[model samples]
Target: MEIVRGRSVLKRTAVGRLQYYEKEEPSVVRRQVEDTERELSRYERALEQAEKELEALYERALGEAGADSAAVFMGHRMLLKDEEYRNSVTRAITGERVNAAFAVETVGDELCRLFLEMEDEYLRARAADIRDVSDRLLRILEEEEKGGGRCGRGPALSEPVILAARDLAPSETVLLDKKKILGFVTEQGSANSHTAILARTMEIPALVSVPVAREWDGRLAAIDGEEGILYVDPDPETLERLKEKKARQEEAARLLLEIRDLPDVTRDGTRVELYANIGGPEDVEAVLGSRGAGVGLFRSEFLYLEKETYPTEDELFSAYRQTAERMGGREVVIRTLDIGADKTADYFGIEKEANPAMGFRALRICLKRPEIFHTQLRAIYRASAYGKVSVMFPMVASLWEVEEAKAMALQVREELEREGIPMGHVDLGIMIETPAAAILSGELAEKVDFFSIGTNDLTQYTLAADRQNDRLDDFYDPRHPAVLRLIAYVAENAQKAGIRAGICGELAADPSLTEVFLKMGIRELSVSPSFLLPLRKRIREICLEETENDQGV
Candidate 1:
């Protein structure tokens, strides 16, 4: 048995047949074609067919997978409609008189190379998505060339297997069968990468940067995601040890299931509202399955991010309405478009900043661009008619910003009332992410229905560290005294104002900090669906009074 160490993204064991996702880099060549019109037609038809295929995939993914997962196909559909991408292929086909298939490969290759050359890691990693979408178009063209028209559905595994890959894009991961795929092991990706985040969200055992995974194709392997170890061609002892570890993990999961439907209560009987933070309508399914109390942070930004341009009020309303109705009267806190910075859409025309994390983003942009902000508010207010829906503003720093956001919502309410549209009770809340918000939580609390502390941003802003920067890992501790103090301060002030105070960030899912939060009397915790059971178990195991007395924590 050979052991390889890698960075683990979750704590679990996966034992199964290994299947590697290795793509053969094609050798693109400009080939002369006899008829240019036919070749151009082939390219056009290929894009059309690719779009149709992606639409089918999106629908299937929506029904089977969740909305965030289904969004990958929508993204693919967008790429298929890229004007520049289509124009580039057309230029190559007409100008060089090359085969249409060859022109597609040529343009796709150039785009992939260009994205890879980008300095930003987010942009560089997006190279995988570009390649994935391009591959779909080429596959269609190639299949049609071979006299195979409209080959059925997507790729799937025959049986359960350990999915090994050179790298996994968020889009490609969506196409994978979650039930058939045991876990992920990649030759590339760091512990803090997007791949890692997906793995954690899925509760899948994953180890990244495992170079030896390149050679583990079609072999039985054992993965220890907690320890970041992979045993290839395991000896009897290694296999037996892995089997036992898997058994223990399964037992732990079963134990967690026992408390699945139970309320999140501490040993001292302090009941907390355990909820979910979701991005789309499909995520409501996961929330229901997990028995989450409600939707704490419905990231309305995702709808805007996925759109080609600004999502119309009707489209936004439909999505939010579906999500609210599905929740069946559960609390649905819809945060307005928190766009700009790293989470940007091209149509928004937000200029790149030297320090985007700290610059004009979230509520700052929404408040400045009131039209876009009002459009989202109108949709959200309309959706609230279906169920319990509250509105929250992100990146709130000062009292004036709070007053301004409330004023906009008031205008939306007045407009909707004048139009005689059915409206629901929409409670206003603010996301305490900036240090300025936390420090003055008491003043801010008096004006809102609730406060959801976005600890991911709060920790970074409090410590003056970038959440995305790996170099700041040492300095970006959420459990740091300063960060906890701020959270406690918010909770305390929120209590005084008779408002619900919750945490909807990575920290809410952290078992290590559960006791601390409980002691602070933080009433709500909304994490990803996978974290629901585990976090509930943690909450039940803690005593708020005991934890409060324990200074060593």
Candidate 2:
């Protein structure tokens, strides 16, 4: 048996026939004009059809999977209507005088080439999304050409198989026939990409970036998605081993559902709030499914990043309100526009930084652009009226910054009340992600209602190492004594100040460190929705008294 390896996007086990799906790239030629008007009309119709399909997919994925998983379709829908994309395609068809299908193919390939040429893999994967959407447009045009006929066109599953592809786009995955599919293996994709999130919602194991998967067509394959192991044409012994492994995994998943209903209390009877860190309103579904008590961190920056224009107050308010109301009164802490550092938007006019990760971003951008800051604050405050809502400022360092942010929020609250807008339960908090914030936790905690330690940033700031830099990973340990010491310091200070102290970072999701966090007097853990159940299980098993005397170091 040949063993092929890949990166695990969503961990699960699957054994089935290997189905190779070779995607055909669109090819078009530059031709002379014959009928520009017909070409433009055809292009418009196809674009409209693509938008309708994307919206339907979004509704379906949102209902079944969760908002986080479905969020990628929203971007696709936005791209369909993007002025730059539309204008480019229109010019290609009208000016260049090509068929609508060819025009779309031309524009899409050009844009995808630029994205693929980028140094960042995240940006490069975006090319696949464009390619996916372009194919949708091409199909619409083809059907139009064929007397408006439409057939069942998607991933054609012949059997319950481990589907192999170059990559699975969000729309493509949603449109797939789920009953006939056992799992998925892709030659290229990002684990953190929305496609991975979609795979999790489908409750199937996915192995991605398997360069050899493209060759395993028609072979019997056994996969351990949990460990990213792929057995190509396994021997009988390997097959039996996988059968046992699959049974254990299925049993483990069934047990995890029970953990959701179980209390997130330690054996010693100390209750900890098991919360989920979300990106947008759609994630509330996963949070509820995982039985999260509250939302510890809602990264509001996504609302800003996904658009060419700034999101309006109403747009931001609706999203926040939806999440708050959906949680059914559970606390939803909305972190205000944390859009600086590595996340700069062209519309925001944020200057390029020599060191973006440590530069003008998040709170720095918000504080500078008072108009942008005030708009989001008002929306968040307004959303509070629906259910339990709290505001969290990211990258906060100084007590004065907290006071300034708090003052602006209060000012916005009064402005809303003056305008006859009703507001509800509002709690303001600060994130202790910098060394300065950790060191000044006692003073900072005194002013805020709570403290959420963002370990991803705290570790980087404290250790002076870039967390995203692969070469420096050894230097960027979240379990480093210094990082733990800072966390311990914050926990102690929050206790002294009688404020709620929680962790909403990658550290909070690590089960091995669950006991360590509880020992530090940290009672709230905000993790990814998928981690809620596992972390809860770990929490219930640990006795805080056992690690009571051990220093974090």
Candidate 3:
């Protein structure tokens, strides 16, 4: 067996025949054009067409991969409409008197090269986005010249196989039929690329930077994404070994499934609520499949991030209502518009910040822009009539922020009531993501109905480290004593105030600390839907009293 190694984005395994995906590279030959105006017009038309294509892809991705991954297309759309990029393309077309396709290719290549040379990996990963946009425009220009038809090679295989590629753009990754693709292997890509993000969202086995040969296209392959290894043309002995491993994995999955309908309880009968965190209504299926007790953290910013404009109250209501109805009476806690930081939209026109993670983001933006907050509150309140719904404010630090948000929510409810809009009782809550909030959780708990500890941000903010910066990976620790003490303190304050306290972050899904959290009187744990059953399995095996002796709780 020949072993290929790379960086793994998703920890899953798949065994299938290899299928080398041959993407059509656009040919942009430089040709002199006498009519500069016509060339410029052609470029504009191609840009518009590219934007439309990306919009449609965004919609498709929203349905297929949910909003978080789908947001890549919105970014693509923004890049297509970027004034600087457009100006560069136009300058080459008009001044150099070159073909629209050739100008686009030249400018796009230069931009990609510049981005790739950036110091930050996140910025460097954006080079793929530039290439994606450029290739899209080129294809549109080519298609228009040929009089209209779909471009690019569609899925070549009728059956699912290990998709091998040089690299995949977000557009190409989203366009492919996910069911017909078993997994992904790329010779050139970063772990943070959009293609990698989509793979994680799809929860499929994916390895990047693996040197793959076209000759192995039809060979039997087994990929272990957790190990970042791909076995090509595995020997009989190796195949048998992989099959046995696969069987064991499947058996473990089956065990998790068996407990899907079971309660979140320990061996000693102590119980806790287990819920799922979701981005949008599309994730309801996963929640239901995992039999989640409820949605503890419904990130509301995704609704705005995926749109070209601010979503209307009706639009917001429709999404929230759909999710709530699907959950079928289970509580759906929708966190109001946690925008900024890594999540942003062009329409918002938020200024570039030196450190956005700690700056004008989340509840700060909402409190400053009551019009936006009011619209969301109205929609959420209206949706509450359909099912069990709760509204939470994110990035809350002090009493004033919570008080102001609550006042605005109250005003919206009163407005809706006066307008004869039907609504239901919606619980008001706040996310204790900041250290200030956690330290003051007792007072904050008395003000809100619940407290959902956003451990992801809490950890970063407490540690004073940017979680997204890989350079600080060793320095940033969520399980640090300080973070744990803060979490336990929040739970204690929540218990004293007679309010529910839960965790809704990366730490919540960690099975190792499940017992500690239980011992701390944490009322709930919210994680991605995929982790629900396995977390339940972990919880069922734990005894809180036994954990106290081991962890000094």
Candidate 4:
């Protein structure tokens, strides 16, 4: 047993491991490699046999316990077949290999080093994922040597296990027992990582990127997911207060669930459209499930993220059509490709820049790849026939860019007509994400149908602070007078142009900012599904007339 102390931050506590593997010579490596190969072969056979048994068990569990239970059983079965992991073991076994354990250790160390060098905090945290996979594989391989036959431990004794690691992979996250697991704490990760996403989906308390997590062990802890705070070794009084807090949280959750079916109205009645910001068509299901008013912002980058080539017109059309069908006449505002040097698709082959975010990206990428842009436009136009779908271009900096995008959109429409692609008209809009875009909002507003203020990027651009950087995060304040003035300017310009303006940013979800936005004359607020109800309640409580009057003051 170990007793270590550390301050917990953001609902995560880290515990360091006491044991470390010693490095050995090449001869030791050869012997271990031979042993590992034998072990790998044995495990492969045992895994095959275990899979057959598990399949039968799964069928019986499905018969007895239902689909959800069977799904849990089957999920474990699939974990065995993870190709990247299997290949790693194979390399350790059959290849001119180092010791399996040492090889895993070396890979983990190298991954950690690689991640540390990465500029993106999210990507850097993936080092933890590599370590986790290697550790799990080593454990499995070691078990095979011991003739435990891949059924080494019975799902880790379910004892309120608080998983403390440098980071967690998506697969390990999925396999953990949710009921017994208290929460997740990681040394490195971001709110956007798959672990965070899964944690939010499962309603688990999680904290990431805690610098001193290595020092925590057996310390009484509390996690507040909503506030993104973690408390360690709380005094008795604090624990009592936390107990009360936990009760209130439970009650709030119960109330929120009950009101899920209710219309989003406050003590005073006012109609406010509550919408979801979707990343792709798959996210449409979540919007539907949450009973969102519409699709406020549909980020089209997911189409470019994993693809080696740009999506064809037909592919884009099918995606848009599916989203439109799911939205069922609700407004779907699709934002055009926003990729840049920071987020390169293989097809784009974007050159890495010193400051990728500030360099050629977003709308700049579209300008450089007009053919790709035209194909997307044609598809969106064709999909418009299915429902009320509108198009928006991201990172527009000037009236010229807006005009150019509009011209390209029109050209796509003309081309579609000539090609007989069954196109329909859709409203074209521009996102105010860059500093220059905010500065020229009045002129740009005249060219676009509407404006969606992407506050995340706007804040970053305005403050010259990378929000991902912890050291400079304090400078990334959205409520900075400059940011407020920019939003106000854009909204005013949008209104003057006879077009509605919407805010679809992390700031939109902040209840405290709702009145400020309403005062700014913003017509819509698109936020995450979790925040929709609370924000809608805030909107309804606001007297827009009073807010507008106060704006002039």
Candidate 5:
């Protein structure tokens, strides 16, 4: 038996025969071409064919998987259609007088390298996407050159197997017959890769960075996803143990589903609102599947980061409207343009700062650029006509910042009304992520309808530690009394002002602190959709009266 360890992407177990996945790499050789025009024409034709294939893949993914997984193909399509990429390919073919295939290979390699060199994790992950799209184009050109019809290709599976690969692109992962695939172990990939995201969304066991080999193909294997271990040609005892573990995992999942439709309340009859945090409209399906009451944090920066340019009001409205309509009248608190700092778009042209974490980010960018903030407000308000919608401002440290953001929202509403545009009631809120905001929550509570404590930043800012810095793990404590006191203060201030205060950060998902939050008067928790049921189970088991009695209340 051979044992290997890797990073786990999901906590599940699988026992099956190991199968190695091999993809044919299309060969491209640089050759001189007499007709540059013809080469460009061939490139355009291949691009068209590749685009159609991606569109078909998107449809398949949308039907088989949920919108969140399907959105990767849409992103691939956008990268395919990007003007700079098209122009780069054109320049290579026409300027070098090279064959279309060679031009694509060279240009694609250069772009992939550039993306990989980027410091941002999001941009770096795009490197795999670039390679995926490039490979697609090459395959199309190869098929056409060989005068053969496109190969009807799929991994031939006679039975369920643990698929092992060097790495998997989003397209490759999505195209696999999921039912025949028991789990995945890749020699290379990160948790942020599209393959990992798809695996997580599918609720499948996945291990990345495993030292897999072709020799293990067809061998009986057991995957312990919780421990990120792969046992190849496992002993009979180990196989039996893994099977038992798999059964227990399945049973646990079934139990969680039993409480999916139940109210998120405690034994003492204290009701807590459980919502989901989403980055885009595509995630709404996951929220609904997990039975989230509403969207606590609709991160609006995705619209900006995904596009090469600023999104139009109409474009923003379409996304928001889609999310609201799908939520079926559930409240969607849209946080306006929380970009800069860790998340940034080149189009914004934000200059580098010594301290970006606390520097010009979030609402600071919005206040400086009122036009951008105004456009987002218009879209949110317009979408409110379809369902319950609210707007929140992030990184709000001072009262004037909240007042300025509110002023812009009011201006957008008035302008829409003047233009005869229909709208609905849109409540305004601010995030209590800054220590200054928490300290002055009593006064700030009067200006906003609700408060959502962003504990990720609150803990970082309060303790003077960078949340992203791994070395600060020992110092950056979310449960620190100082951080909890701020959260309690914000919740108390909200209660006095007759407004709801919720937590929409990583801490909200920590089941260990569930009772602590409940005792702090925080009755609402917004977390990743996958955490909904487990947290609901924890809340149901808690009796707040017992804590009160222990405290001599």
Candidate 6:
């Protein structure tokens, strides 16, 4: 194979000349369904036999090598139980069928077509799941035919294995030995995908959306996930440089940890509250480990996404209480369910819309599902009694939405009181994400106790560009004049209202925007723990009077 390489996103899948576009008549569909059911039954029987054989292997391995070998065997069992993998096979069986010769090829072709048509990079890359499932199934079938009778060896575990995939499913990413996985290189993915988020949380280096990466088989490569760059087939000298760079990174990380305990202050004497944006209760440990000032934004959607059913009041209460208690006296701002059009809850059965981002989401979903919303409201209210808890509504567009949300919150509070449930008052806040919300900041300030500018959505809406679109990424500027203007408007309104305004968006963590945000009179800036000290130092360096004086310039 000629070594033709391109600088591409690691997660982009290869498109091949697979004939899946052939028209399927009604008869074909019926025949395919019947064949699929038979194939599924055959696989089920094979899977059963594989399980028995696996158990036998485990017993033999354990008898020979003790519990350590059995542990490795058990790990494979857990991997087999992965829901995403199981679901992929189920989907394949239910949706289409063909002879083994054509099944894998057809699935691959269909997945490629589906991926190409998808607008979201994250969803588009789901084609990889189809490929991964088919590949595994084909291997199992081949082994069975060859009378190998199920290969039982565990995956070759390595330290810092660069996971190269078309795209990683959540289950694959979650189950991977994070410590051993050095970095991830995918043909497709965005920063918001579960794999990307998990990699970031784990501090694993990752590069995504590399077009035609599968063609670069076994080529010497170097990647810096922190910088989102990949170096293909580096010479010895380049490899040496990378090694030096790695050493510097390790040293810098070590130094950062050493100084983490110190108060973030610059040459001057200004202080900034550096907080962490957390996903779940489990994230609280990491936040505390980093000595975060408080939980700035507790993404409550995690609870909704992880469970099959809506989180009950007591379950919600425990989660909120755990977070609050972990933070101790520090402020914890809990963002209400931000789910809407695109991110529908299976249990809620939210209808899919043409434009999910603009349609019912966040606070909008709560209005439709009052019972679910009320449960969350009650939990937040109850948790407030433990520590400082602020309830923030996301994607607030109109004064009516804010009013309705606040009224419902109060209703929940009243219901709790009538039942003699112990609860406390919470500071109500609105996320200024939409242009409508930003434009009406003065009006919104009147109703809400605080404002948090969500720059991610704000930038996207203002620029009229999908942030995930690589072609439109050039327009996703946080520093754009219009975006800055919206931030200024919200800050000015919050100042006039005499209520604190903060930023919990990705922009808040940006070192470049730290001074600009401070100049705009933002009182609090909540960022990831990694950015805390640098931001704190940046704040300390600026004199408030000098900042205010330089505002005109």
Lowest lDDT sum, 10 consecutive residues, model 3, at 149-158
Could you tell me every candidate's TM-score relative to the true structure?
Answer: 0.87, 0.84, 0.86, 0.74, 0.82, 0.74
What lDDT, from 0 to 1, does candidate 4 have?
A: 0.66
* Candidate 5 TM-score to native: 0.82
Clashing pairs in 2: 67-282, 340-361, 340-362, 341-361
Q: Which ten residues in a row have the lowest lDDT in candidate 5?
A: 148-157
The sequence of per-residue lDDT tens digits that candidate 3 reaches over residues 1-553 is 8998888877778889999987877777889999999999999899878878888888877776776678778778877877779999999998999999999999999999987887654466567778888988898999999898785334566899989988887777777777788788998766656678777766678998899789988899998876889999889997888778778877987888889889988988988899998889888998898888999999889888777799999999999999999999999999999888777787888885656777789999998998999899989999999999999999998999989999998999998899999998999999989999998998898899999999889999899876765456567799999999999999999999899999998789878898788888996999977789889999999887776767776
Return the lDDT, model 1, position 484: 92
RMSD of every candidate to native, in Å, equals 3.4, 4.0, 3.4, 7.6, 4.3, 9.0
lDDT of 2 by residue, 1-553 (tens): 8887887866678899999987654345466669899788888888878877877887787665655566677667766776677899998877777777778888888999987887654355567778778888887887777777542145778778888898777776776778888888887665645677678767778887787556688999988987888888899998998889899988987888887799999988889999998888878888898899999999898788667789999999999999999999999999998776545455776654546777788888788888999999989988989999999999997888888998898899889989999999698899999999999998998899999999988988888876544346347788999999999999999999999999998889888898888888899999878789988888889877656645453
TM for candidate 4 is 0.74
lDDT of each: 0.82, 0.82, 0.86, 0.66, 0.86, 0.66
Give the residue spans of candidate 6 off by over 4 A.
1-194, 209-221, 224-243, 530-553
- Model 5, residue 507: distance off in Å is 5.0
Residues 91-164 of candidate 4 have per-residue lDDT tens digits of 76566445555555555566568767987653454455455444555555455557665332223423665556
Worst 10 residues of 2 by lDDT: 466-475
Report model 3's TM-score to 2 decimal places. Answer: 0.86
Off by over 4 Å in 4: 1-157, 160-171, 187-202, 208-220, 224-236, 261-270, 545-553
- Candidate 3 residue spans exceeding 4 A from truth: 1-5, 17-24, 110-125, 146-155, 158-160, 176-180, 187-193, 209-220, 232-236, 417-422, 462-485, 545-553
Error of 2 at 191 (Å): 2.9
| Candidate 6 minimal-lDDT segment of 10 residues | 18-27
State residue 8's C-alpha deviation in candidate 5, in Å. 1.5
Candidate 6 achieves a global lDDT of: 0.66
Q: Whose lDDT is higher: candidate 2's or candidate 5's?
A: 5
